[model samples]
Target: MKVTQIPFQKIGFFSKTMLDYLEKNPKINPFYNNFPDFEGFQKQIAEKQTSFSKSSRLVLAEALKNQYESFEISEKTKTNISLLKKEHTFTISTGHQLNLFTGPLYFLYKIISAINLAEELSVKFPNQNFVPVYWMATEDHDFDEINYFNFDGKKVTWNRKDGGAVGRFSTDGLDAVFDVFSEHLGNSKNAQYLKKLFADGYLKHHNLADATRFIANELFAKYGLVIVDGDDAKLKELFIPFVRDELEHGTSFKAVSKTIERLANNYKIQVNPREINLFYLGDDYRERIIFENNLYKVNNTEIAFSKDEIFKELHKNPKAFSPNVIMRPLYQEVILPNLCYIGGGGEQAYWLELQDYFNAVNIPFPILLLRNSVQVISEKQARKLAALNISKEELFLNQHELITNKVVENTAIETNFKDKKQFLEQQFLDLKEVAKKTHISFLNAVNAQERKQIKGLEKLEKRLLKAEKKRQTHLVERITILQNELLPNQSLEERQRNFSEYYLEYGITFIDVLKIALKPLELQFTILEI
Candidate 1:
């Protein structure tokens, strides 16, 4: 296996805000407490320790132990869980939706990034224990987004009706999804392994939350990846104070709204904060809680509570309250003894909107780091790319631009009209000089003529490019085919293709190879060829 690192700027897939944040642009400096690096963790660790109490740590450890008890927890994971009770222990977390079969290739990358970063920090701060955490977005209600995963060009879907927090959704319908997958998987040993894996995860487990926990633990337990579902009573008990504050004063909405306004001056706001960001969770419903008519009302429902009644409800059933996107980060930070957050670009963007809120609530904001973005190419594909004289950088170009450039490169014609334009500019320069000796109107006419001539040259250049493309049809087709393979469906392979597609060929070693290749602190795009 070989690995190549490219800066995110060259990849052109990240947003300007993400790019700037990664580069530590002064504009983004005000939004985050500490920049993500080994040095940055020092200040974050100190701040988190000052606020994270012994009682909170006990609650967190107990919740994790209870969650891990149902599964076959590895020795390393048990140790990591025990370490959470120690003052020297801290967590590095990355949260994700319970996407079926680990929705995209990046899901694995995100967790691997957290694991590798925790390992690095353990070595760096030898006295302190670092644990990698995968916080399951169990309360996320977006069924349409998490119900399907792309395998090769086909979408393996679980077409089922679901409601409430997705974590509680029954896994009874996954058998049909498994049959569809089996038909595509054929009869390889890896396929059989995956079949059993899916059966043990979804078919055997009662709910989506447990199924996802089983699947993630199966794949990553060796590295001691601690999985936590936030929809637990014990965890919510720790967050009750903040939830109450949200209900009383709407603190998060006020602070986050200010930050969003300031952020919108230069960057796009990722998520808008509602007046009350907490939601009321029921058996088959997760509805927003809105304060209106001097009463706490659950959106789209007739259930309403007075201020005193709502406070009593929160104390009795803290788990019944779920935080939306805006408040979820605060909830996670409140419950865990975490130092940094590892996430994708979009996650970081919304997190940026919450720093002011974190400050307002008097909790230390965790350092936000974009997870490692990867592009995997086969050796055969690498060789083909070389034969076409395409560099690694060329692979990142947009589809049309890549094909156009290849067409021009393969054809025996000059597609660029730069020299012609330069010559025309020089002629115009001479004409302007001559017109200067005559009249101002004559110079204006020369300027008009120059514009007309440049427009003509541009038109000619387009026609020549079209002619060259027609002549190099075969070359264009080959390039298109190669690009499509490298970037499936003209999208990033990690975003569209599932990891199982590669696992079939490489087996479990595929994950080991990524663990070896990924450097969470490197903060660059990686291209790995296996």
Candidate 2:
């Protein structure tokens, strides 16, 4: 949201294009207002439960225990937990789909947004509690996406035979990752901090769930943001009833299905329909047998669940079930005692597709907020704009369109017989009106004569404009070269290329300087060349 203005030179030229474009196009995206509406929805949610709800408390307790167990809660998580206990008026909650080594810097932006928002709300709400909660994407099924970080010129990736959930992937599998990271850190003064971060989190942890928890805990633990993994025995117990209902009535698909269909009517994006026959899983306690069409188990254990019995047990203990697609929001509602969930653009889209399911389950849908995204510019990019006589604002325009504006503005058409053509067209219009009284047929002849005259003038204008363009061909060529160098790739700063480009000038404080003026939620990446 904060940056320099477009250069003064290009602004004057773009102003004319702006005026022309405004004449032709209505200035709004047609899809802008079709957002998921909350009419009568908030009341339904508030009525469902508060943080004080039994299910909500259970979720928090389970998440805390899981995070503690996962990381061995060095003094770090303990300190963070203590801060939360002391300042429990409000908390920010941010969630991510487990990306390999935390996908992009946007992941960082999501958490930072949650944290900053919680801080803002604390000032406004004064007496209420706020805590920033990180929902560890422990259940995400994709492994290929969540396994690497691009550093320097090399991709530091996990070499593993991945299957099932990333949460349960063992930490010991990340040794090769640490080796690469250590090599990169190589004798730097801050190597120790980076090394410990990798060690206690990656090398020593057991899964993506644990490693992410450790890293988050180390950074914001002191600030009281709690990281939680949802996949745990105790946590599953909280949503046991919902889980059972999904299996019994085949409700998840049926319930969430209705929402998706309803959403398809309004939102442009359509979500995949939820499945009705859900997968059944429980600890095997008998002979090994694969149980779907048949039965299966290992180590003297057999699958002990039947669809009906699971439901019966869940009905007996609502606190014991975990909800699938139809039930997750119900479970999250029951457990988190949260007021809102801050999500990324795609995440918000999917969440919008599921509101009807929340309605079906008698759960209130949480507030869905989109995280902000941004581009960073350096001193060089800023100066380049000025030198080109292009305003900083022009950077936001499509590159080709901006080029066309520059070309048209600088081109000088020869005004050969300009007034004569305009004067003749005006005379014809005057004659057509006067001729109407003498004979209605004569009026038509006069109108045709005016049209021919206008066409001739338009043709002459085109030729003049073409010659003017030819005369300024060198300038047009220069602008095209600059446009290609500046754009072509959409990024404001080429991140994968280098940070040393800025860091050499800023030194170790480059990160601190960036974190100062910008909110973490505003921009996903930044390239600050001092």
lDDT of 1 at 107: 95
lDDT of 1 by residue, 1-530 (tens): 99999999999789999999988898889999998887899888888888899998999999988987779989999999999999889999999999999999999999999999999999988989999999999999999999999886999999887789999999988999999998988789998998899899999999999999999999999999999999999999999999999999999989998898889988988899999999999979999999999999999999999999999999999999999999999999999999999999999999999998998999999999999999999999999999888899989899889988888877778889999999999989988999999989999999999999999999999999988888888888888899999888777889999988998888998999999999999999999999
Question: Model 1: C-alpha RMSD to truth?
Answer: 1.6
RMSD to the hidden true structure, all candidates: 1.6, 8.6
Write one digit per residue (lDDT tens) for candidate 2, span 1-530.
24332232332322322222222223311211222123322332334334345444544654586558635444644544444433233345678766655555556556766776666555655655566688876655466777776655467778777655567676766777777767876655566666676687776665667777777776566555677666665666666655545554555567556655654453444346444323332321112112354221121344355556545655564432323333454555555655566765556565655666666665656655455333445566567666768765566566656665666777564445668787997898789779977887888888888888888888987677666657777766776666555443443323232333233344445445444544432322232334
lDDT of 1: 0.93
For each candidate in turn, the TM-score is: 0.97, 0.67
